[model samples]
Each structure stands twice: as C-alpha cells, then as structure tokens.
Target: MAGSTKTKAKKPTVKKPSANKAAEASHNGAAHAFAPEPGDFRRYFDSGHTHESLGITPETLLDMYRNMLLQRRFEERAAQMYGRQKIAGFLHLYIGQEAVSVGSVWGTRPDDPIITAYRDHGLALARGMSPNAGMAELYGKIDGCSRGKGGSMHFFDVDKSFYGGHGIVGGQIPVGVGMAFAMKYKETGGCCLTYFGDGAINQGAFHEAANLASLYKLPVLLIVENNEYAMGTAVHRASAEPDLYKQAYAYDMKGAIVDGMDLFEVYHAMQELADEAREGKPALVEVRTYRYRGHSMSDPQKYRTKEELEAKKDEDPILRVKKYLLDNELATIEKLDDLDESVKAEVMAAVEFAENSPVPEIETMYEDIYTQSDYPFLV
Candidate 1:
C-alpha cells in the first residue's frame, strides 16, 4: 500500500480566532458567568450610624467634611480644566467617592502608607498633598509632585507616605504588600492602606497579594473601593463573586463591607480594619461607593443607565455629610456655605498656582529614575 502512491488523509487546520472576536467571546462568557447575590454584602458598619457614640468630636467631623469638600471642589476644578484643555492626558475624577478616600485616610495614622489606583486626586488630597502641587502635577508643571511627571494618575508624597497613584489596574496590590512587609519588618506600627476598585478584585495580583498577606499576617489593609465598575464594566458583569469582601474567605482573612457613601461608617470600618492590620492581621474592606463622573475625561459612559446614576446621586457622600452637619445642628447653613465658598476659592487659587508654575525641563527626565547611580554606561 505504501509503494502504490496512496493518498494520505489531510489533518484539518484549526484557525485561531481574531483578538476582537476572542475578547468578545470572553466578555460574553463573563457576562453570563457572573451571578451576584440577592442581598447586600455582609458589613461591619451600618449606614446612618452615629459617630457621637465613638466620641468623635464635632471639630473632627468638621475636619472630615472640609477634607471631603476640598477633594470634591478640587476634582470639580480639574474637570473644568480638562474641559478647557488645560489639563491633558487622562483625568479620572473621584467625584462621588470622596468619603471613601477621606474617611479611610482620616482613620489611619499619619505615618501609615497609602497607595491607590488612578482616580487618585481625592486620596492624594486626603493624604495632605498640597492642592497647588496636585493641580500643578495635573498641569505638568515643574512645581508639581513627581516634578509633573506623574500627572493625574501618579500623585506621590514620600514625606507623607502617600506612595503613588498607579495607572495600571491592580498593579499597586503587590507594591502595597511590599510596603506592609517593610512596616512589619521594621516594627513601625504603621500599616499600608492599599486601595483598588472592585474591578481589581478580579485581578490575579489581588488574589496573590491577599494570599501572601494572609499567609504572612502582614500588616496590610486591602481596601476595595467598590465604585461598582472598573472603567465601564459593572461589578455584576466583571466579577463572579461581586461581593468583593467575601473573596477574603479564600485566604481566611478578616473581611468587612462598609457603606462608603456614609463618611462615618467608612471611617469606623477603616479604623477597625486598620487597627487589626497594624496588629499583624491583614484584612479586606470593601467600601460600597460610586463615581458620579465617567471612567475618565474621554469616557462616553454608555455602560450604565441614567436612571441608575440618578438613583445613586441621592446618596452623594458630600451631600450626606452636609445633611449630617445640618441635621445634628452642628453647623448652620451660613457656616457650611462659607466653608464651601472657602473651598472653591482654595481650589481656584490652586488652579492659578498651577497655571503660573513652570514646566519641567527636558534635561531632568533621567533624574529620579533609580536610587543606585553607578551604571557602566554612564561611566
């Protein structure tokens, strides 16, 4: 048979699908595979809980309000700047999620390190980065933090222990763990507040970091700023376990969900979790928050409905704090109005400062690249 020039059967060639088609298939699979729970995620702190029981003074409350308001106004101005083409590149506004950053920051000690994903202006402001420097950074000015190299997504203040605003999704998870490991190694009594969006919870980096943190009992608080979406994709669509805090169960780490819209609740939850983290017990805290703005300046935002956004507006964290101040008779309307006006003026001044600041020099681009400078090429 072999010598008779027999026709061999040909094996079928399997053509791999296009990248777009493969992505579409993957998206469809994810969309269908996700199954969210019917009820809310289990939480440590309830909304509408009074901080008076915890002896949080009215002055502290006012400070919290001011911090949140400052962030809100700063972002509002940043958005305006983006509209005017003054602020270039990506601008991810942290409009409605102010309480999450402000409250969590206020709960932590001054020396505790903070690292978050982009959409980080609020966290930087909350961590005491100067509004002028932050705005200038957005403007790419020489006076800006990171010498204007970082822009909107990479705000860093080494003195304040504010690590960075990482642009890559979930990239800061392991970095934060490393920071926490350093804290534990040095016995600094300072924990790392590692923040990422609910979208990042699906990332393998998050799981690996969480596992390592739990395994080593590193002093790290993994905070998921569950703003419901990762860019355009909603939690229900992207995550198999949309209840993000429950993912901590896999590592047997303590976990809690908090009302991120309520500043008091966020502060309390962060305080508890951060304390535990500092005591060498890693924890996961999912702050259920929302963003009023689109993912970035360029986003068209077709993923979610207008009605859904409107519904979330009623729970605006800034508004909630304002209501709390008024309802408790802690501050008169005039005082609150004055505070708002002051914040607006401060934000405007920051914008002016950024406008006046000089741009970075081309020669300095190679500076701050590395700590050790004895390169063979330089020699």
Candidate 2:
C-alpha cells in the first residue's frame, strides 16, 4: 500500500526584487489596499542617476559621505552635551535628516540664500557653517554664530548666505519669498531654498508665500521637509491633502517629490528644481525624510512604535551612499574610514572650542539691541 502512494507536491518559487526595489506584487496590488512597502526608498532622477550623468567623481561622493557623517557625529555629541545641560533651551537634533540638508545645499550655489525652521543646525552646518561657531552657539557662548543670543533655535551666517534659524514655525517662508523677490528684482540670477516641516506647511505664512512666489515667478524653491509627524501628530491628521507637493499646483507652480533618505535623489532633484527656479520658475519640493529623535529634547515620542524606527534605520542615507560607493568600487573601505575619522576629529575639536569659549559680557547684550541717530538731544 505504501509503494502505491501518490507523489508529494512541490512548493512554488517566486522571484525576489533588489533591495532598492519595492515588491512588484504590493506595488501592483489594489490602489486602496496599498500600505507602506519597502524597496529602494530613493527615487533618483530618470529612475536612477549615475555618476557620469551627475558629473560627480569618487572624491565628490566621498566628500558628500564625509559631510553626512560629520553632521551625524556633531548631532550625537550635541545630544550628549544637551543631556549634560551644556546646551540650554530647545535642542532639536537632526539625527536622521542629514541627507535633506547636505544634498540640497550641495545642489545649490553658496550664494543661493538658504532659510529654514528652528531645526536649523543641520542646514547651517551643511551650508559650510563652521563646526566651532555651530557648537559655540549651542553652548550659548559669544563665539556662537548668533553670539550666544539665538541659542539652539537661531543660527545665522551672512557670509554663507544662510539667512537663519527662524523659531516661528512658518515665519521663514515669507522671508524666503522676500529674498526670492529681491533676487528677481535685482536680477541677481540666484535661487532661494525655503525649508519648513510638514506642520509648518499648513500655516498661513506658507500659503501666502507660495502665492507671492508663484504670482511673481520668484526664484524660490519652497521645500516641505515631511518627516511623517509634526510634533506628536501624524501628517494625515494635520493636512487634508497630505500630498504636499501637489499644493504647488494650486498656485500654478511646478512640484515634485524626492526621497530625503536617498542622498542621490535629493541632490539631483534639488539641483534640477534650483536650476529651474533660477530661471524664474518657482517650485515646491516635498522632501520626504524621517527624524529618529523626538520633536525636541523634551519629547517622549510615543506616537510611533519601536519597530517603525528600526525599520527606517535600514534606509539610513549615510549607509545608502556607503553601499553605493563600495558596490561601485569607486572607493576603498580605508578611504571612507579615514574620511569618517577626520570628521570625528573635527567635531571633537569643535566641542573643545565651544567649551573654552567665554559667555558674552552683560554690557554687550544691550549693544546689538538699540542704536541712536545723530540728533542734538540732551542726555
């Protein structure tokens, strides 16, 4: 009876996609049934941009990686200092959003005015702000970019053309519009990068700024750094049309979305949009990113689960670029390590400099506050 038994059935074999590709099955599944699916998070220009197309060399790639690592290390150190109470007030650490800052900054010129919300340290540092000045500012010392007055929320460097660290949620949007209008007025042939969080995008200032930018064809790239949550609320709960880039169409402006975790995607998209903006074609770019840290040092971050954070880490922008470099054979492991070591040393030196810096004199506090005109008035 056993010898006459039927044969066993074999299991079905299915093909697997690359790490950079989402599951074809899910992507091709029912539209309403879609959920967050994984593959390559970066949506590169023309599907994927090559070094030849982007005109970048091994050194350039290495430099980008170095900047990202530097930002990461600097923030990590800043967190330690904050825990130790070296940095007072609100300390919003840009732990996972380095790519959006570094890549977008690189996509534009040094003279292109850059402005953003209070989470400003990353943007400032990426736009060539010295680590010493940045760290000193956090320490509330006189050597800080804003000279101990602005604290962690406001960092300014006129030379770098980084306008500020604006504290009022969407306030910087109007300032960016003014900057763009000036560029258009003077025919300066420059663009402005105005960045705000998903929460800030809902404010009146952002809408008004968008209208003015589009109406006058101002050279402004309005960027919404959508990191999923605004304070404690998810994006869906805040904005009706969560597709923020599409908001550009309301003002008759061009719009696009870039994966902020993908450095290549961010850089290329920013570059293209910036170039277009320089030609007086204002655009709104939604840079989808994630912040591993809480909204601020004070936040408990109970909105999301631990599994979500861990899963997102797998899409770390730094690791993404590193993998690209290694896979392409463009750089050796030692070279990358050396780059990282150099950055670490640099950040350490900045911390040392910040520690040694002196606090501003009480008398100097009232100096930048008021000025007198040459009027013949008796004291």
Candidate 3:
C-alpha cells in the first residue's frame, strides 16, 4: 500500500468535436437540426398573426397588439417621469423588447409562474399590473405594487402571479426552477417562465439551473432576452459564441432563436414551447431583441453609434404590431390613435396618483423585509 503511494488515476479527457462533426453540425445549422428562420418559422405556427395559423382568434390578436402598445406607452411615460426626477433609482426601460414579454406572457397560462429581471415593468404591465400602480411603485409611492418598498427594479405583485422585479442578474434562475419543481412535484401541470438577459446567461447560476431543470425535465421555460448588448457590452465582445440560444445544447435541451422584434413570432414560439414544457419538458428560447434606451437612465451613448441604434429602432416591436393590425384591416388609424390617447391619459393618471400617494411610513419598513416572529426580538 505504501509503494502504491497515491498515484491518482488520469481521468479520460473527452476531446472537442472533431473537424468532421463540427462541419456537419455547421451544415445542419445546429446540433438540434431545427433552428427556426424568419420565413420557415412564420409559416410553421398558427398564432393568429396570419390566417393560416391555428387557434388565432381576432380577439387574441387585438389583445396582443393592445398589450404591446400599453407596455410601450408605459415605458415612454416612465422615461418622461424619470427625466423629470419624479421617478428615482436605476430605471431599465424595456423599450424594444416589448414582444419578448408580451408574447411570452400571453403564450403561457394565467396562473403560471413568471419571473424576470429588472426590466420587468413590461412584464408586469403585460401580466395585468395596472399602469398607475406600476408607475406609482417606480415613484416609490405606497400605492405601488410592492407597497412602495420596491422601486423601479423590484415590482412584485403576488395576486398577478408575477414573482418579482429581481435585481441580481442570474439570481432569479433558481427561483424559477424551484417554482417549476413545485409544479412538477404537485403535478400542477403548470410551467415557470424564467427570463434573464444575455449577460446573465454566462453566469454559473444560469448553467447550473439549466442543468438541473433539464435533468429533472422540470416544466420550466428558460428564456433569454438577448438584446445584443449586455448593458453596453455587445454579445460578440463578451462571449466567444454570441449565439445564446445554442447555449442550451450544454444541457441537451432544444433551443430556438427568434426575432424578438416580431411580436407574433415571439408569441408563437413561446406558445409552442410553453405547451411542450407543460408536458414535463424544459426549453430555452433566446429572443434576439434590442434596447433603444441605455442600460440605465444614467448611461451616456458611448458604446454604439447613433446610426446603429436608429437602425434597430426602425424594427421596433410596437411599430411592427401597429403595421400588422393596419395591414390586416384589424384597426384603422383613428382607432389606433384613440387607443394611444387613452393609454397616454391612463399614464398621466398614474403619474398624478403616484405624486399624491404617500411614501411608506418609517415603521412599515421593518415589517416587509422579514416575516419571522423573532424579527422584532432580533431588531
């Protein structure tokens, strides 16, 4: 035994993919063999964007369009309030990624668990959080969803089934997995939509949660809002492979790349995969959207060119929906204008309400942070 003396056996090291397999995978587009394109994907699902897709009612289309508009308007109003110093704190606007939230939320069932990053005002609005309540929260007013405890990045509405406006980049991934685990354990037949940005995808939490979620075949939809730039750092600069969708292959799960600017595409893709997830399979969807606003309100345009930003803005999600509605004769310009006016008025009311709303009393601060009986004793 002494002579055998602690020689650690060399573990077999698997080689990287050979040139042949890499070429084949390249020819095949991805390891999964089903990377959706704009055209093929457009015709594949019946999400009511066109007459060909199934289960698309007129009401659903209208609802989707309306929700997209509402989110866009809400953010625009928030930006104005932020500029006026009415809303304080770091405000991350989801100006262009409206489709990701609107489509994804609409794709899932009402009672399903929804968790997202700090750019969650859109998700909250899409999930039926009142604009007034959401804006009020951004203003740190008591009438806000978190009762004024959470500012822009911490809106939590329990009744609406939205988990939180989580501040940490990849922190919510496990929370979503846990939610899915609950659904699986209870056989609830529901799914949890865990959304984070492209930047967070590189975090260890993302990989670990993805591994566990796939290993257990939990009903979880891990969606990446790959908006090109991770807070001013482009995906190419930050990652070896900017294709965030393919990152799911590490977990042996299917992933899809989608045009995040296209609401119908976002909605249909999410709907398809969410239905699959409910059947006890996990999935990853990377939405290739862009943000028109800076990483936060305080950011200056030092990273990219204005031309680039303007180009991306031309493909805006709200504008796309508006065009689709007009092209299909779903709504007239007057109708759209009226809707805009109504939304603007609603946003105005939110501002007025937030201004009048009281801030949390000093004593109330000690209450929400912890629910334990010994909290007072410790304090």
Q: Among these predicted structures, which one has the highest TM-score?
A: 1
lDDT of candidate 3 over 1-379, digit per residue (tens): 5666787999999998566766777774555444543322222223356623636676787788888888888888889988899888899999888888888888778888899999899999999999888988999888999888889899888898899899999999999999999999999998898999999999999999999998899999998998888887989999898978777777777677787888778778888888888887788888888998899998896899999998998898888778878988888999889988887888888888999999988898787774665766665
Task: State the TM-score for model 2.
Answer: 0.86
Candidate 3, residue 318: the lDDT equals 85
What's the CA RMSD for each of the models? 10.7, 12.7, 9.2
Q: Would you estimate the TM-scores of all the predictions?
A: 0.87, 0.86, 0.86
Q: Give the TM-score of candidate 1.
A: 0.87
> Model 3: residues >4 Å from true position, as ranges?
1-54, 373-379
Q: Which regions in candidate 1 have their CA more than 4 angstroms from the true location?
A: 1-42, 45-48, 371-379
Instruction: Report the CA-based lDDT of candidate 1 relative to the real structure.
Output: 0.88
Clashes (N, CA, C under 3 Å) per candidate: 0, 2, 2
Better structure of 1 and 3 per lDDT? 1
Model 2, 55-77: lDDT tens digits are: 87878877788888988999999
